[model samples]
Target chain A: MDVTLLSTGIANVASVSAALARLGVRAAPSVDPETCRTADAVVLPGVGSFAAGMAALNRHGLGTALKARIEEGRPTLAICLGLQLLSESSDESAGTPGLGVLPVQTVRLDGAPRLPHFGWNRIESAATEGLVQGGSAYFAHTYCLRPSGRLEEAGWRVATSVEGAPFVAAVERGAVVAAQFHPELSSTYGRDLITRWLERARAQSAVDTTQGATPCR
Target chain B: MSMTRIIPCLDVRDGRVVKGIKFQGLRDAGDPVERAAAYESQGADELCLLDVSATPEGRGSALETVAKVRAVLGIPLTVGGGVRTLQDAERLLCAGADKVAVNTAALARPGLLTEIRDQLGAQCTIVAIDAARTAADPSRFEVVVRGGRDRTGKDAIEWAKEAVEAGAGEILATSWDRDGTGEGYDLALLEALSQAAPVPIIASGGAKTPEHMAAALRAGASAVLAASIFHDAETTVAAVKSDLVRLGFDMRLVSAPMLPSVSENSPLPS
Candidate 1:
């Protein structure tokens, strides 16, 4: 499957691309809105501040195109800062607006032993289908998304946690899914997660083709 | 809880892996790609490639080696030595390095740390401090540069604190006196730096056994880095990890299937 990886200009795109290639999926790094809109799947991989990331997306004119794809129920995966960028705003860069795809806010992980929650931590998955529940993934960030609100009516659910403080580890609302961990650097479990996402993209493409929709470019 | 990382440092000069006794008497270890792949298969948590030459002519070859090693390895790769400017760090990152370690240049111009951090994020910026115990004052350690050939009078602990405040996310503290001696890590130095630096401290130099690693971790190091042990094949990454686990240190274990080999059922795409 061909996937368009949105480059926020601060992430390690090479590593993300290599991870996807290992899962048998072709990944092309692009900030072009048209390319992102035409792919079988779109991955928003990032590793920088919310302000810098959002500025890059706006500079490339990809802000609206990305939101439209997710709103249309297209397969999209946001990792780390990419996940934080989906929120309404973040404490990391005060007053900076996020993509606002998910109704959430990102804040510094207070009361933790350190600032950047660096290293591997076990993720207790809330759902079974979208991500591998009960597995550890590598994390390296100081801020995390506050837990989803009101379980029943909330559009998203908590996919994982580190410590008792629950954050949006993986969120699934329609075709929009995201993880607060670096799957590209999470070793075996990371590879498995990418494989699962690619399989879903392939399955979705098959369905679209059967319904006479244009295939992803 | 954060897992303790085991990093194998490959000192590369002229594009070849080299090991020396206290930064002298350099000898070839092996090809960078081959040794890096071998260590990865052995379950090394991370790999550090330090260009010993750190010269204009050698910088090109070091980046080429980094790209080649990155192509075959899946773990995080940190390239150090000769990273003086933001452009140098950018070039290494573009070549597939997850992080870049800066030492001499950062010390010369402290602002370089902040500059690199602003451009690349603190997570990608690591300050490598080479330190030696002061003869007059055994309690305090002095910073050394030029591969431990010169001493700068600045206290090691003070320098670490300054580097962290300057936006360095981690400190690679190498004990120059204990380096390559196989006498084990300088626990007193690790303890002082760990207490002084807010960011994670990677205890480097003079690691001989798993017990030594344990001692460093107990003394408050976030990770343990060694060169001679892994390069000389006196021990394996898996063996050291298992030993650490037995001693109750949190370590990431590589499952049997993850062991190095070309399998017919490999999950990698064709």
Candidate 2:
């Protein structure tokens, strides 16, 4: 299946793209809004400041395109700062507007213990099946998303409430999946996750084909 | 709660694992990848590779070696020594390195931390602080830069806070005062930095026993990094973790599923 990964001017996108490649999935980097509309699935892979990431998406006019795709039931995945940018706003920079995909806000945990939490941490799975396996995944971030409601009930959000606030580590909404960790760098198990998602997408397409229904991909 | 970590430091010189005394008179311990795989098999929580050479050519070699290590190891790997930019970190990550540790570059340009972390994500960036206890004040240690070649007047505590604030995800603090001495960690420095900073700290330098590991953890270090003891064959990573587990520390047992091991048929470096 064709997987178009959103590249918002962030470096080292090949890591994620390569993981998808290993899964028998073709991963392409998309910096254009038009590309998001045609892909079977879209993955927003980014690392950096929320403000800068948003700026790149806005500059490329892919920000609006992403929301439209999500609304259309197309599977979308966000990673690291990409997940944080899905919120309404972020404390990383004042007045920075997120994609508003999830009803949440991003706050910097600079005072909690450090800025970027760099290491492997456990994520107790909220749902037995989804993008996140019921185990510890690697995470590296200072700011995290705090979703308002049961949106995170579909996935195990790693480490809720660092010091005082509920931080969202992973999120899943039907076909949409997002994570705060870099699964590409997460080793063999991590690579397996991408494969599972692709298989799920493929299986869903087969069912749609049999039923003469439109595939979500 | 986070699981306590046991990291084996692999000091590399000329593309092979080497051990030295006081940063001089080096001895070939084993191939870095072989040594790393052994430690991983023995329950090393993670692995750290520090390039000892101070040349541009050596830096390139370190990156290549990192790629080789990442290709074989399934667990996380942190690479240091001459990491100077976001591009360097990017290359290492693409090569399969889980994290990149920076020392002198961070001190020279504090903003590099944010740049690398922002570009590659913070969890993949580790700020390695080389420090030494100050004679004037035993309570404080000074941050040393350039592979412990120059001393920065920056206090260890202050630098730790700054590194964390600047977007460093973790700190691999090496105390020159206690390095290679097996005297135990500079607890005062560890406590001060741990209390002042908000992220996990990896205690390096002066660790000679399993007891030192427990003491550092009690002092708030989430992980303990020891080079000499492991490299010199005085102790094994498994032995240390077992000791820590026996001491009631929350150390991971490192099942074979969690760690990486080299195949028996693979070429073993002499």
Write down the TM-score for model 1. Answer: 0.93
Q: Which stretches of candidate 2 lie over 4 Å from their true place?
A: A9-27, A109-115, A150-166, A187-189, A205-217, B34-45, B73-76, B84-98, B109-111, B114-125, B135-139, B145-154, B161-169, B228-239, B252-254, B258-270
Q: Considering every candidate listed, which one attains the maximal lDDT?
A: 1
- Candidate 2 residue lDDT tens string, A138-192: 6667787664554544332333423334456577665666787767655555666
Q: Which stretches of candidate 1 lie over 4 Å from their true place?
A: A150-152, A163-166, A173-175, A214-217, B257-270
Kindly list the interface RMSD, in angstroms, of each predicted candidate in the order they appear: 2.0, 3.9
Q: Write down the worst ten-residue block by lDDT for model 2 chain A.
A: A154-163
lDDT of 1 by residue, A1-217 (tens): 7889897664467778777776667787788998777667999987777898888889998888888787777888888888888888999899899988777788888765655666677777757765556676777788887665642255665676764366656777656678888788777778788777777777887888798876432
* lDDT string, candidate 2, B45-131, tens digits: 678888888788887888778767765554567888888887877777766566789888888898999988777666777899888
lDDT of candidate 2 vs native? Answer: 0.73
lDDT of each: 0.81, 0.73
| Per-candidate interface DockQ score | 0.47, 0.33
